[model samples]
Target: MPGGRLTHGDRRRIAAWLAEGLGYAEIGRRLGRPTSTISREVARNGTTGDYAADHAQRVSGDRARRRRPARPAEPPTAEQPTEVVRGFVDRFATLLAATGLPRMTSRVFVCLLTADAGGLTAADLVRRLRVSPASVSKSIGYLEAMEVVVRRPDPGGRRERYVVDDAAWLRAWQADTGAHARIAAAARRGVEIFGAGTTAGTRLGAMGEFFTWLSEQMSGSSLTASAVYDALTVLAALVHAGRPLTLGALAGALDWPEDRVTAALDAIRRQPAIADPLALRTVGPRTYTLTTRSDRLSQAQREALHR
Candidate 1:
C-alpha cells in the first residue's frame, strides 16, 4: 500500500487514527504509506478537527478523475519552450484555484498574467490554452463579471481583447462595495425588526457596524489609490523607526496635515493585513507602533497588503 492508491478503508483508518491523536508518522506506519502522503491527504481533505473518511474518499476520487493520467517521458525538442516559465504559470494557477477560482478560469487568468502581450483575444487564448472556443468564452465571461479582467477593442480592428492590468484589483474592490452596502442595510433592518435587546439583534448590530465601516472605508472620497500609497508610506516609516510614534510625530515625519495623517491611519486600520497582523499597537493615548515585521506576514496577509 506504500505506493498504491488510498482506498476507502485506508481513509477510514486515517480518520480513526487521527481521532486517537496519532501523529502522521504513526498513521503512515499503520497504513503502510509515507508520512507525507498522510499529511497531504489530511490537508487536502479537511482539518484534523473535522476529517471525514467518506468525504475525503469522494473528494480524492473526484480529483483523480479530473487529473490526466501520467504518460511516459519524452526527450526535449528545440521547438518546445522551456519548462521554467510553464512551471511557474502552473504553480500560480494552482494558487489562484486555491483562492476559489474555477480551474479553467484560474488557468486562463494566469495565462494572461504571464503573457508578454499584456492582453489576448479569444482566439489567442484558445490557441495558447488548447481549450475549445466555448471554454475560453466562458472563462473570460466569469473573469469579466468578477472585475478581474477588462475587455478592450483591439487596435487592428480585430475582436475584443481581455486585459488584466494593475487596476484589476482596484476594479474588484469597487465591485464589492455594493455588496458591503447591501449587507450593512440588511443587518441594520434585522436589528430593527428583532428588537435591540434580543440576541439576534445584537448579532445583527455587530454585523451592521462592521460592514458599514467597511463600506465607508472602501467608498470614502479621500481614500484614493494615491492616498493608500501614502498610507503605506506612513506604515513603512513607522516600521523603519522601530518604535512607537505619537499622532503628532507621524504628521511631522510625513510633513502632512493632521487631518491627512488621521485619514490615512483610518484607512490603514480598515485593512485586514495591517489591522490584524501588523497592527498599530497603542503605546499611549495617541502613540502607535508596528508590532509585526516585514518577513512575518502570512500568505493571506501579504496578498491583502499587496493588493
Candidate 2:
C-alpha cells in the first residue's frame, strides 16, 4: 500500500479507501485517476485478506517488461544467412520433440518464443518457419490451444500476431493441469483393460487416482499449484541468476530432504518447465540431473479416462 506505481499506487489507496468507507467514485475523486482504472486495479490485484503489494508490483513489472524495447533485432543479417539458419530448425525441432511436443509444433512455438520481438504474424511465421501459410496456421492453432503463446492485435497493420509473454511458460504450466486431468481419467480406465483384479490394473488405477487427486489438490485446492510453482520458480530464477546456492540452502528454506529436492528437480527438468537441467545444477550436490519420462503414467491415465 505504501510504495506504488500508477496502476498499482492507485490500487493501494483504493483498498484503504474502501476499508475506510470510501466508494469507488469517492476514491477516484481522491486519487485523480479514472474510476475504471482504480476499479480494475483493485479488482485485479485485491486478494482475500490484502491486495498483496509485492504481487502487484511483480505483475506491473512484468507488464512493463512486455512493453519494453520492441523487436530490437541485430542489424538485419544478410538474407543469405537464413538458408544456413533454416537448417537449425531441424535441431530446434528435435529438441522440441524431445520435450514431448510434436516436431513442427515445437519449432513453430520456439521460433516465436525466441523472436527478438517476442511476436510474429502468420506471414512472418511462414517466412521464418519456412513452411506454407497452412502449416503455420495449423501449428499456431495448436500452440494457441495449448496456451503456449497468444494472439495480439498488431500495431503495424491488420494482421494479428502471436505474442509470447514473460509468463508464457506459466500459461503453459496452467494448461498442463487440464492435460493431467485427462491423463488421470485415462489411467483409471486402464484398470479395466489390464483386468481390475490384476497387478497392472491395481497399480495403474492407483496411479490414475493419485495423479488426479494430486493435480486437483494443486490446482483446485485452497493452496494452488500455480502458487507453489511460482515460489519455486522464483527460487529457480535466483539460482539461474548466478548466485551460488547450496543444496542445504534450499533444503533449509523448503524443509525438504536433499534427495527429495533432487528428485523434484529431476521431475521438472524432464518436463518442459526447465528446458535445461544445467540451470538447476545443484539438484544433488554436484550430481548431474537425469532425464525422466514421468508422463508414462499420465498417458495411461488419459487412455483410462477414454475407456
Candidate 3:
C-alpha cells in the first residue's frame, strides 16, 4: 500500500466502469488517480484483453504481494505516536526507491526531506549517513544542480545545512521532467540503430511518448504532480553519474541490499544506447560523477531517440 495499489473493490469498480465503456481518463478521475495509474492497473491485470472484476483483483493483489513493506503499520488512532518526521522519511525513501534513484542521491534527499530541526549541517549528514564529507559535498552539489534542495547558511552554526523548501522540490521535479524527456528522446534514437518495428526500437519509441506524456501531465501543482515525479526521481538517479556503477557499491551506498541493486543495474544496462553497457560501473566502486559530457550525451541520445 506504500504506492497505493488498487483495492479489490476498486478493481471491481474498474471492470464495471470499463464494461460501461467509460474512458481511462474518466475512470481515473472517478478513482482520484492518474490516467497512467488507471491504464497500468487495468493493463497489468485485465486478462486476455478482457476486463474481469475478480481476476483483476487477484492480479493487483499479486502485484502488491512483494511490494508491501514487512513492518506492520502503527494504528492511526489518537493515542498513536505517528510522527510527521518519520512519515516524511519513510515516504521520501519509498518515493526515491520507486524512481530508481542513485544511492548517494537518494540518501541525501532522505536527509534533506526528513531532517528534524537543524536541516542537517554537512557535519550532521556526514555523521548520519556515515559517509565521507566529500561524498556529502558531491551529492549536495548534484542536488543543488537539480534544484531539488537548496543550501543555506545556518544562523546559529558555522556550517551550512542543505534544506528543501516547500517549493524547491517542485522546482527539482520540473527540472527532472525535462531531463526524462531528454533521455527518452535518446532512447527513441535507438530505433534507428535497431530499426523501427524491431522489438528494441519499438520499446524505445514508446519510451519517447511515455516521457513526453509524463512531463506534460506534471506541468502544474497538485498532490498527483508531487506523487507522479517519484517515478522520474528514480530514473534521474541513473543519469546522475557520467559513467557506470557496481551493483554492490550502489546497493551499499543507497542502503539497499546487494541483490536489488544488481537486479536494477542489469535491467537498466539492457536498455539501448545506454552509452555505458556495464552495470558494475553504473553502480560504482568510486563516487558517482555527472560531467558536462554526460549531460550532452544524454541530450544527444534523447534527440536521436525522439527522431
Candidate 4:
C-alpha cells in the first residue's frame, strides 16, 4: 500500500481522475490511497470542477515549507519512550474508531488525552499529527460537538487550545444520556404508531422502557457518572445478597468504608421515584433490602403477562 504524503505525480493523477468524474473512493482505489486522503487533498486544493495539479503541487509545497519552521521540538524522555507512546496512541485510536467514532476524530481525541498539559493548540495538533490544518479543524469540531473536548484561551498566547479534562468526560456522559432519552422518545412514538396491542408495539414498548430506565440511571438528579456507578454497585450487591443486610455488612461485602456505603445509598435514594423498578427498602432497624416496585409495569403489560 502507498504510504506517506501524496507526491506531485499523485496530484496530477488526482486531477485527471477528477476530470473523469471519478468519486473519491474510486480515485483512492486507483491511487492505492485511502478515500479520506484523496478527499482531503481535493478539498484542500480546489473543488472537483476546477482542480489544477500544478497549482495543487505548488500550494502543497508552500504549506510544507511554512509548517517546517512551526514544528515544535520534543525533548527525549527516559521515563516513557516516544516510540512506545506513539504505538499506544495508534492502538487506542484504532479501538476508539471501532466503537463508531470517526477515525480522524478518534485520533485527535487520543492525542489530546495523552498531551502532557492535557491540552494542545490547533497548530500543535497539526504539527504533531502531521495532518493538514483542515483535517485537525474538522476533527476538533466533531469532538467539540460530542462534548468530549473544549476550547480554552492558551496560557502562552492568543491561540485557543483544545483541552480534555475531567469535566469533558462528564459533558460527554451528559451528551450520551441525552441520546438515550431521544431513543426512548422515538421508541415511544413507534409504540403509538404501531398500536399497543401489536407485536411491533410490544417490542417498541420494551425498548422504550429500557432506554428510559437507562437515561434515568445515567442522568438522574444530575449526579456525576462515578456517583451513579457507585450507587449501582451498591444496588447490585444488595440484589446478590438476596436478604436484608446492615450497613456494616454491606460495607464489608464490597470492601468499602461504611461512610462510603452510606453515601451510595443516599445517591440511590436521590433518584427520581419512578426512575427505576428496584427500590432500596429498610426492612429492619439498620438493615436494607432491594425490593421490586409493583407499579413498574403498566396495567396492559401486567395483564398481558398474566395471559
Candidate 5:
C-alpha cells in the first residue's frame, strides 16, 4: 500500500474509478488504500459526484505547502485599514462557519463576499486570507461545488477570478432543497425494500414525507420575477376591492390576461410567506379575498414578505 500522500496520478485514478460508479470500498481496493482514506480524500476535495482530479492535486499541494515553515514577516503597513478589514473578515467568517460551512471555506466566502469588485483571483485570496495558495484553491473548489462562487477568465488572460453572484443566495437555497429531495428519494427506496407495514418501513416513509414536504415548501416559496409581480398585482386589486370576489370577477377587475391572473393567484396561494402577509383567503368556490384584519399576520410573516 502506497503511503505518505496521494500522488497526482493516484487522484487521476481515483477520479476515473469514481466515474465508473465504483463505491469507496472497491476504489480503495484498487488503490491499495483504506476505504476511509478514499472517502475522506474525496469528501475534502469534492464529493464523488463533482470531484476533479486536477483540482484535487492542486488542493493537496496547497495543504502540504501550508504545513511548512513561513518566511520572516515583512513590515506591516496601513495598520488601521488592515485591522478594520481583519475584524470584519473574522466576524463574518465566524458567523458563516457557525452555519455549517467549513472554517477555511467560510473565510474564503466571506473574503469574496466583502470584496468591492465582487470577485477575487487566487493570488488575491491568498493575500487577503494570509494563507497558502493551496488553501485558497481547496476552499475555492468547495465553494464552486456548492455554487457559492463562480470562476471567470481573467481579462488579462492570467489567472481566473472567483466571483460571488447576486443570485448566490438563491442558488444556495435551491441546492439545499435539492439535497432534501435526494433524501426523500433515498427514504422512499427504504420503504420499498422494507415493506410499508414494517417498523423500519414506517419510519422511512415518514422521513421521506417530511423531506418531500420540506422540498416543496422551499420550491413553492421561490416564485419567478414575473410571478412575484403578477401576484402583487392581483393582491393589490383584491385590496382595492375590499371584498371577496369570485375568480371571474377578480379576472375582470385586473383586466389582465385570464391565464396570467390565474397563474398569479396559484403562486400566491402556494407561497405562505406572501399569502400570510397579504391576508389572502379563499372564501367560496373559486373566490378570493384579502383581509383587513391587521392582526391576521404575525410580525415574522410580515418581515418575510418584504424580504
Candidate 6:
C-alpha cells in the first residue's frame, strides 16, 4: 500500500491532514507514503487551503480511464531483458536526479539515452515515462538549454524528435565548464569585496584559484575529449622520439591514419599558449616536433631557479 497508487480514501485523509495544517512529512509518516507522493498529490489536486478530495479523486479517475491499456508483457531476451532495462532506467534516473537534475528531466534524459533509435518524440517519452506531454516538453527544453539534447525533424512525421548523441556529452562538458568560469569570476569579486588581507578574502582567493585552474583544465580546447586525448598522445610520441617526425612516420609509428595524426597536431597548434606547456613546431615540410615552453614554469618558480 505504501508504494501503490493513492486511493480515494488516501486523498480524503490527505485533505483532512491539510485541514489540520500538518506538514507533508508528517502526513506522509501517518499515511505510510513518501513525502514527495503526498506533496505531489496535494499540488496536483489544489493548494493546502482549498484542496477538495472528492474532486481530485474524480479527476484522477477520469485521467486513468483515458490512459491507454497496458500492453502485454514481453518475454525476457538474452541480450536485453525488458525488466532489467526498466530497472536500470529507474535507477539511473534516480542517480541523475541526485546530481541536481530535476526528477522529471532526469527521467526524460534516461529515456532518450536508452531508446533504441537514439531519439524519441515527445509522445514516445510521455507514453514511456507515463507523464504528461507538458512535463516532457519542459524537460526537453531544459536539456536542450544545457546542450545535452538536440532536436531533429522526425523522418516519419511532422513531429520533431529529441536526440542525445556522442557529441552531446562534449557540449554538456563545455556548458558545465562555462559555469565554472562564471563561478571563478564571482569568487574573484568576493575577494575584492572582502579585502585580500581578511580571512574571508583569503578563502575566496583560494576558491577562485581552484575554480580557475579547473575551468582551464576542462575548457582549454573546444575540441571533444577524444580529440584532446589524441593530441596528447601525439605530443607523447614526439617526446619519446626526441626528434622531429614526418606525418607519415608518426602515423605509421602510432598505427593511426595519417589524417588522424595531422588532425591531432593541428589540435595542439590551436591550443592557447597559457593552456598548454608544450608547443608544436614545424622544422621541415610535413614534419613536426614538440618543444616545452620556457614560460611553462610559474613566475615564482622561474625566479627561484634564477636565484
**What TM-score do all the candidates reach, one by one?**
0.45, 0.42, 0.38, 0.53, 0.50, 0.51
- Please write out the lDDT profile of model 2 over residues 9-68, one tens digit for every residue: 655666677777776777777877667766676678774256665577788888888888
Q: Model 5 compared with the native: what TM-score? A: 0.50
Candidate 1 per-residue lDDT over residues 49-72, each given as its tens digit: 889999998998888878977788
Write model 4 residue lDDT over 153-241, tens digit each, in one string: 98888999888878887788888888999999999999999998899998998899888788877778487778778888888888888
Candidate 2, run of 10 with poorest lDDT: 270-279
What is the C-alpha lDDT profile of model 5 across 148-248, one tens digit per residue?
89988888868898889988989999999989989999999999999887899978987986786677678875688888888888888888888888888
Worst 10 residues of 3 by lDDT: 271-280
Alpha-carbon lDDT, every model? 0.80, 0.65, 0.64, 0.84, 0.83, 0.84
Q: Give the range of the ten consecutive residues with the poorest summed lDDT in model 6.
A: 75-84
Candidate 1: how large is its RMSD?
Answer: 22.0
Question: What C-alpha lDDT does candidate 3 achieve relative to the native structure?
Answer: 0.64
Cα lDDT tens digits, model 3, 94-197, are 78867877667777788777665457678777766667989989888877787877778889867787788788867877787678768777887887899876
Candidates in order: C-alpha RMSD to true structure: 22.0, 28.4, 28.5, 13.9, 20.1, 13.3
Better of 2 and 6 by lDDT: 6
In Å, residue 50's CA in model 4 sits off its true spot by 45
**For residue 39, what is the lDDT in candidate 5?**
94
Off by over 4 Å in 1: 1-82, 219-221, 224-307
